[model samples]
Each structure stands twice: as structure tokens, then as C-alpha cells.
Target chain A: MAVYTEIADEELERFLAGYELGALLSVKGIAEGVENSNYLIVTEAGPHILTLYEKRVDPTDLPFFIGLMEHLAARGLTCPQPVRNRAGEALGVLAGRPAAIVTFLEGMWIRRPRVEHCAQVGEALAQLHLAGEGFAIHRRNALSVDSWRPLFQRSEEGADTVLPELGAAILRELDHLEQNWPRDLPAGVIHADLFPDNVFFLKGHLSGLIDFYFACNDFLAYDVAIGLNAWCFEADGALNITKARALLAGYQRVRPLGADEIAALPLLARGSALRFLLTRLYDWLNVPPGALVAPKDPLEYWRKLRFHQSVDDAGAYGMDL
Target chain B: MAVYTEIADEELERFLAGYELGALLSVKGIAEGVENSNYLIVTEAGPHILTLYEKRVDPTDLPFFIGLMEHLAARGLTCPQPVRNRAGEALGVLAGRPAAIVTFLEGMWIRRPRVEHCAQVGEALAQLHLAGEGFAIHRRNALSVDSWRPLFQRSEEGADTVLPELGAAILRELDHLEQNWPRDLPAGVIHADLFPDNVFFLKGHLSGLIDFYFACNDFLAYDVAIGLNAWCFEADGALNITKARALLAGYQRVRPLGADEIAALPLLARGSALRFLLTRLYDWLNVPPGALVAPKDPLEYWRKLRFHQSVDDAGAYGMDL
Candidate 1:
């Protein structure tokens, strides 16, 4: 729930002049993306999302994100397509920040996703992976296995204060993951952060996936691992194997996972859990004064990591081998 | 930029069952009203604003707010009209809060309002006051002149911490306003908080006025005073008399102000300035830690109040005598 950059009306009118979007009807700051300011702008043409990239987003990587969305949408993937202005540029500057407008997707993300929603998300995820093939740009996952140790090191000193012996536990887990991380797997553009909030559903049907800021070149199965950690966990820290089975089955129906990818599921899940835990831990320990967004609890991911540690193989996730 | 209430997708779907809005398409938390959770919901029927009343708003006043809007829109004012459900009800409960859906107005509020915009706002405000006549449900202005002293008393101890001698100045101004406050002036439904953001403009035309939570029975001239303080003041704390002239002249073109109303303008403007000042001062001094909305600077109103105090008569506000 943020609108960091306030755009003046005249400035916005001037900015919209570059586009053939017609006269601006209304521009409302939407509580959507956390890293960037998003506006659900309505014009004489129709509704579109006007996003102003904040400092957190690397400008160099924006082309990749925008290009990936365009590529995916072009291949019949349900996603927001970047709308090019009359100048034939998809991106522009507004309020002294890099901004772009994308066609508004009509759907709401499910809060309490049911088994069917999970299945739909799985199918959609696989479809996205298939559609992302041969995208011209490549961006490495910044929060992948390699970045965890450096991220954990920054938050290590204060980690124990969050949970008992948490710092020591993370250090041990990081060492194990760094050594055992999968080197060769089916790699593609993965929506690294396919959280439930980023996936929209309408009338019990998967409408689309959004927030491609975290999309990068990574193991396609690693993206599924992130989805499992994000969607398959319950409030009591227990894994819902029924939903997991449904999710895995749905994905296999679209694009079957390789033997190596399936073999690495347990480790990938653990790695995904660690990735979120490290980021959340750093944010929790380094919350600046008067920050708008409260840091999510790192211990939730810690508990998730522990659960993955208990899983000995992909079978534990109810994957049909 | 706040979304205090998190409405579940299932719950929202169930809630929408009562409305013939054609299966809910999308609901996005909008950064609009401060005292309520507002979502820009779009369905087959079209876009509407769904607002959940927060704790700040009194539940008893909900009827007056909704009824007044209905009344005003029926009278041909270009404000948001309350949308009734199948049960012919405008209000309902959503996420344990009183909520209602209103037609979405199409226009953007001016960030830097020009003299023409001020004229439009002035004309529109006068139209609102006239249209609000004969509204059966009457609500007293909660933050009127009578409430200032008590409000100031709450923030008096820390007022000077915001500005040197702010507390003393406020106390003196409160006494002056309370004693000299107009009585027996023409009274009707006044949009007491007619700030620029509440008024929307499109293609150089006044589209509508919104946020009627502050609409109440008060002297219509006092609403003009608020408009003067809000739209006529430049960013640097100086009054733009040319804008003020256009504003007052525009209002007179609709419903001419009586000599008594004109004479009371300066004192009413000072009182209006003090009304906002006291509330802002209280909020500034009493901001809760981790509160999402930052308290507006109280001294901005203090400066406006000081300027109002220097005005001798309505002519000083560029009122044509």
C-alpha cells in the first residue's frame, strides 16, 4: 500500500500526451506492487496500470522484465502486456522515475487459495515456463543460492533475537544448500516470486500471472519449488500434501518435469525457503524508522525450511513419480 | 495509501452476491479516503468504489453520509451516487466493517489547481450546497468552530513543539472565533472539507465532488471559507487573491452571497483555518508508532490561520463588494 512518487496533474497530462491512450479520466494510486508505485489509470480508451519504478528496481533489468512480459503475452500467455506509446516506446519517465503503462488485467488474486486454485496456478506456472522459452534477454536470479550467504551474513548477528538458535541453523543450512545446489536442470524464465498475491483468479479460473519484477533465468523446477513454499503451507506450519499433489499433477499435465528436476525438489524447496528467509531476516533486522511496510516474519520461512528439511525426497511432496 | 481491512476473495464474492454487478471481475485496494478502506471494483456492470468505514467514522453517521449523497445526486450535482443492492440497500457489512458501493466518478484531482480550476470548484461547491437543501438526515459539523477549543486543549501541551507559540496563538484564535462565530446565517448541507482532492476535474470541466463523510448541516458561507483556504492559498503560504476572486465570483454566479455572509467571510475563513489546524495539531502530536498515514504538518494550517487573522474584511479575500 504505497504511492511513493506523487505525480502532479499537469505533469501527468503532459506525460500521457506521448500515448494515444486518449484523455486521462482518472489516475488512482493502487496498493499493488511494493517495490514500485502503481496507478490504475483510466482514460477515454480504457483502464491501464501505470507503474513508476522505484529505486529498488534496477533500471538495467527493467528491459528484461518488460521484454519478458511482452514475449510471454505474445505467445498467448495470460499476462499484462506493456502498452507502447505513440513514440513506439513501452517505457517512459514520469515523476522523475522510470514508468510504464500495461493493459489492466481483470481479476483478483485469491487470498485463501483452494485446491482447484492451486491446480490452476500450477498449470499457469507451467504454461508461463513453456511460453518464456527463447526470450531474447537473460537476467540471473539475484536472490538465488549464490546470494543467500552474503544476505544471511548481513542479518546473522541479529538473527537469533528473532528465533532461538536461528543464526546457527541458517549458517548450517546455507553451507548445505551452497554445496548441493543443482547445477544442471531445465532452465528458463522463472517468475521467482509466484506468491498467491501475484496470481489472479476470476470465477474460479486462473486469469493471469503478474508482477514479473522477479522473473529471471533459473531452473524452471526452482520456480515450482518457490510456488510450493508459497502456496502449499498452512497457518499451522504443516504442508498440505493433497494440494501439493494436485499442484504437481496440474503442472505435469502442461509440461512434465525431468527426472533430475523431480530428484532435486526437496533441496530446491529448502533453497527457496532459505531465499525468502534470508531476505525477510535482513529486512526485519534493518527496518528503517517510519517505514510504511512492516517486515514479514522471518521465522515463518524458518519453520518452512525446517519442514523441507524433514522431507527426504520428492515423494514426501506427494509428487507422482 | 492505506488498506486497513483485508477483504478475502471468497468473502468479497459472497458479498457481491447481493448485488447484480455481474460476477466480480476485479477489486483493487485504492489509495483514496483516509478514514476508510476503498477498493476500485470493476464488474460487468462497470467500475464502482467500495468503501469500508474505518473506526474513525461514527457508524451512526453512515446513514447521513449515504443519504446525503443520494439526495445530492438526485438534485443533479455531479457527485458519486450510492449504488443500492438487490435489497434496495446502499449499506452493508464487509470484513466486519460498514461498507457501501458508490458509482466511480471519472476525473483526476488537480495537484496544482489553477485559477480556472478554483472557479470550477467554487461553482461546483455552491451547486452542492444548493442541491443539499431539504436533506432529511441532518448531521452537525463534527469539526466546526464549537469543537476547536476542546480539540486544541487535547493538543495544547505539544502544539508549541510543532511551532513556537502555536499553542498560545491557537488558544487566542479559538476564543476569538467562538465568541464571534456567526449565528442565524443561511444553513444547509455544507461540504465542510472541500479540499482540492475531493473535487475532480476533466478536460477543464468540473466533473464531480466526492468524500462526503464531512458533509453536514452548517452555514454554506463557511464551506466557501474552507474552499478559499484550501484552493486559494499558494504553496508558499501566501493567498492567491486572483484565484480567490475567481472562486468567490464563480460561487456568486450560482447562488449570490448575502451581505451578512460576505461580511462574515474573513472570520469564517479564520475559523476554518483553525478547525483544520487544531485537528492536524492533535494528529501531529499523537501519531501512533508504525501508523501508515503520516500526520500532516500542523504548522501549514498555522501559517494559513495567521494569514487569515491578518485579513480585515471580505474584500481582502477578493470578494467583489
Candidate 2:
């Protein structure tokens, strides 16, 4: 039996043959991943990325994804726009898997991200949130706190592996989080995965962003918290003041944060941390034996979730913003 | 096409037809996941979890999983053991996927864990490390420093989205990380995914551990660092003093740490923080469309990683072992 599968190049080529692009030069399967098979396609009209949906992706969601990206792009968000075929549909089958082409974003994602890089992400996130003001499509924040209890149910048997007291603590945290969760904040579309790789830059200037798969309507500050969690952390688990300040400052420049956003940051951060801890915890329980998929260390998010529980002040995360 | 596929009752029943345990009662696929399709299976053999390997699991590693559980079970680690079939193999094919039966543990993972609870986890972790030494199999820590580059590459495309300075900071951190990464320390198999859920308990005592997907050889202190990253954090992105002390004290009680391990902890913590930051950052870049996967808030990790970079002493991380 096949351990892993991928879409065929010829199949992908056949699917793209009907696209509007004048020429397709490169169709390279990027070997750098374990999820979807992605081909970097260079065309005479322009460069684009073709991704063959893998097992993790449900084929039915293809339209939603394509539509989401197109919607965000139309809203002035700098994300990949799905290309339509002669049928004016972005959804198509390639290699027996649902697939489509997305315009290749131009800037290289910095592997060696610096403190200031986080600030730029903060700015882009602010813009993304602002641009998401009236997006036609919507998706529930799938990893929200309301869903934690069910995730807990799946791993309930192994609760002792964490602690006999954990069940209560988790429930308590959830309750506390529920009571204290931020409300009355700027709500809008968010690039829920604003990791450095998803945001692009060129010659010291913001270029475009890609990968809006997790985009959803949520708290604006939660987006900032996600960026803070990703961009400002040091290797030893310390919060970099300079990086945090830079990110906040940059974000405020484009879209000044409101008081409620600041007030809600601590809880938002906790919620976000818990979200990761839960998912990583779930994945940790069930990673495949031989699959190269790297299992995320839930311990880190566990710590962050615990840390976020301690925060009461907005300043604890950064300068008030 | 089935948006959520069901494990056929006939197939599931036949799969368990002749088990010494008895007749099947019910099985329901649990969704809200990206990997395995888990069924809450109840049979004459008793209630057990039926996990259908989906996207991420490779079949070859099933034996290691099967073996590891058996080994842990022998060593008194409370965990689910893979049930062998009538043919005597622990693994089987089902629904076009690799499958297994694991006795469901009973309990709930704590979300808002207390300092005392963290202390318990710390002690349990040390015990796990001690028990890990006797396991027959050996696998090098795959998530060692070598893993960071691939993750960095994944996020390299959109590096400047957050900040241009972040790229330099990341390279500097990596360089500093390489220089300070611990090479000389106690090495043994680790329950690498030792989050709260993986641990099981009855009332107040630790009972069992479940997920061993990330088990491997690495600096024992690295495991401590993992714990520190998990249990010693505050909600506002700072370290929790009491929880930190409790956990470290508990760990030291069972397995006294070396001075070198103690001294190297600040760096170790930083490395641990970076490991998660890079992975989280990479995940941030790669969320699949239409999937329920939530992109973890990278900002919290960013905060933790930056903190690690700031620490110059193990004491900063509350290491006393």
C-alpha cells in the first residue's frame, strides 16, 4: 500500500493547459513539504503556484479556499489570487486530487527573521484586519476556546499523563477564559497564519502575503497575539522588548489599535496559546509512524498557555498597543 | 464524496469479529481533526479507541508504536497497548488506512494547571526519563538542531512580512543557538510530547502516558527545558516563579541534574524556544485551505523565543537542579 501519495505532473499539466496563462515553463514539485504537493509554475503570463490537494485537504473545500483567497485579494489584501480556467472556475482536478493555480508571490520569505521583521508583520496584520472589514466569505475561528472541551474529550483517557489535577485546571482555565474573554473589540478578517513565511517582502519593502487557509473572522488583537507568539519570541522563551515594541509600533502606524484591543490582549493571548496547545496536543497523540510530518512540540504552547494565564496587563506583552 | 467518511459498521465489526474481548456495540468517527479518524468504539472486549490512520501516519512505524507501548507497559508506564489480532499482529489494514485498537484511558487534561500540578508533571517527567533508559529500542532525537533549517526554509519565502530586521535576528539566534546548544549531557529516550493530555491519572496520582510520537534520545535537560517551556510560563508571556520552582524541584528529586546541565539551561531553554518558534512559524506559513486547522498564534512563541535570547543564566529560567 502507498504510504504517501501525490498528484502527477502530467495530470497537473493537463489541468492547467486550459488556463489563461500563455505559457507554463516550470512545474516543479517542491520536496520541502509533507502535506499538499505544490508545483512552482512559471508561465509566460506570469509565475504561479499549482497545488494538488492531498489527503489532509477535503476536495469540497476547494471552492471555499479559492473563493476566500480571491475575496481577500479583491479586498486589497496582498494574498495569492486563484486563477480561473475557461470555465471561470478556479477549482479543478489534477493528479486525481482537487487542485488549482495561485499567483506566485514575489518576495522571498526570510528564513533568518529579525526583530524588526515581526514589526512589519504587525503592520501587515493590522492592514489585513482592516481590509477584511467586509469580506464576502467567512469561516468560524475553528480553534476557539469553545472547542477545547471536545478536544479534551478525545484525549480524556490520557489526562493523567498531564496530571490528575489537569482536568480541573483546564476546565477552570476555560471558565476563567470564558468569563474574561475579550469582548467589544475591533472584529474583522484576520490572516490567522501571519507567520514570516506567509508574509512577503522585497528590497526592505512589504510586498505581498500568501497562504490564507486559516483566515477567519476573529478578534483583531488575537491576530497581533499570533504574530507576537511567532515573531517576537527568543529561542530561550524570553519576550524581546525591542521586537515587541517594533511590531506594535508598526501595527499602530497603519491601523492604530483601540483601547478595547489593548485591554483584550492578555485574554486574547491566552486564548491563542490555548488554541495551539490543544491542537499540538491532539496531533502529538496521533502522529503517523513513518510519515515525515514533523510533530509540533505541545510543551511549548503548553508553557505559553500557562504564561498567558498570568498576564493581567496589556503592558506585559508590550508597550500599550 | 463523503465530507466525513464513516468506518463501515460491517468492516469495523469484522475487524473485531473474533477478538477475545467480545461483540461490537458502536463506532462513531470523530472529526474536527486533520490527521486520524478516531472512533469511540465499544465492544464486548470493552470500550476502546479505534484510530484509523489518515494523512500523517506511515505504516512502517506501527511496529515501533506497537513495540514502544509494549515496552512501556512492561516498565510500568500506564499507557494504551496496541491490541494484536487473531493472526497475532498488532497492526491491521482497515478502510484503506493503517489502523489500531488502543484501550481508552479515562480522565480529562487540565487546561489551567496549577504549580503543584506542574510539580507533579515534573516528577513524572523525570520518572519517564528514568524508565525511558530501559527501553530496548533506540532512535536519535530527530528534532535536534538539524530540524530548524528545514523549518526556516519553509518560512524563508515571506521572511520580510514581519520585519526585515527579523531575518537578521533569526540568523543571529540560529548562530548563537548553534554555539550554545548542549552536546554533553545525559542522553535517553524522552516522552517528547509530554503535554498534559498525554499524561493520565486517577484522582490525584499520575497513572499513565499515551503519546510517544516524539520519543527519542536527547539531552535529558532538554526534556526539562521542554517541561520548563510547558509548565513554568505565565499567561502574559513571562515565566511563572512558583510553578517554575515547583517543577524544577520535582524533577531534581528523582534525577539530580548535573552542573553542566544546570548551567547550560539558559541556552537550552533558548534552543527549545527556537525549536517551537521555528515550527510554529513554519506552520503559520502553511495552513491548508478549508481545513479546520488553526494557525497557532506565533506572537506568544515569539515572546518566549525572545525571552530565551535574553537570558544569560540558567537561574533566569528557575533551574536549580
Q: By lDDT, who's the top model here?
A: 1
Candidate 2 CAPRI grade? incorrect
- Model 2 per-residue lDDT at B211: 65
Can you tell me which runs of candidate 2 are displaced by over 4 Å? Answer: A1-321, B1-5, B30-35, B162-164
Give per-residue CA lDDT, model 1, range A158-240, as digits (tens).
98899889989999998899899989999999999999999988888999999999899999999999999999889888999
TM score of chain A per candidate: 0.98, 0.89
Runs in model 1 lying further than 4 Å from the true structure: none
Evaluate candidate 1 and give its CAPRI docking class based on DockQ.
medium
Query: How far does residue B102 in candidate 1 sit from its true spot (Å)?
Result: 0.8
Encode model 2's per-residue lDDT on B1-321: one tens digit a residue.
002334543466578874656765434343222346665555656557677776565666566667887877777767777787778877787877888888766543444567877888888888878777776777766677877766687787765575566666777888887776777788887776676656654444566677666677788888888888876788799988788788888988988888888888878777777777777676677765433344556657678888877877777756643
Tens digits of per-residue lDDT, candidate 1, B41-151, equal 999999999999988889999999999999999999988899999999999999999999999999988889999998988899889988988899889888888788888
Error of 2 at B18 (Å): 5.3
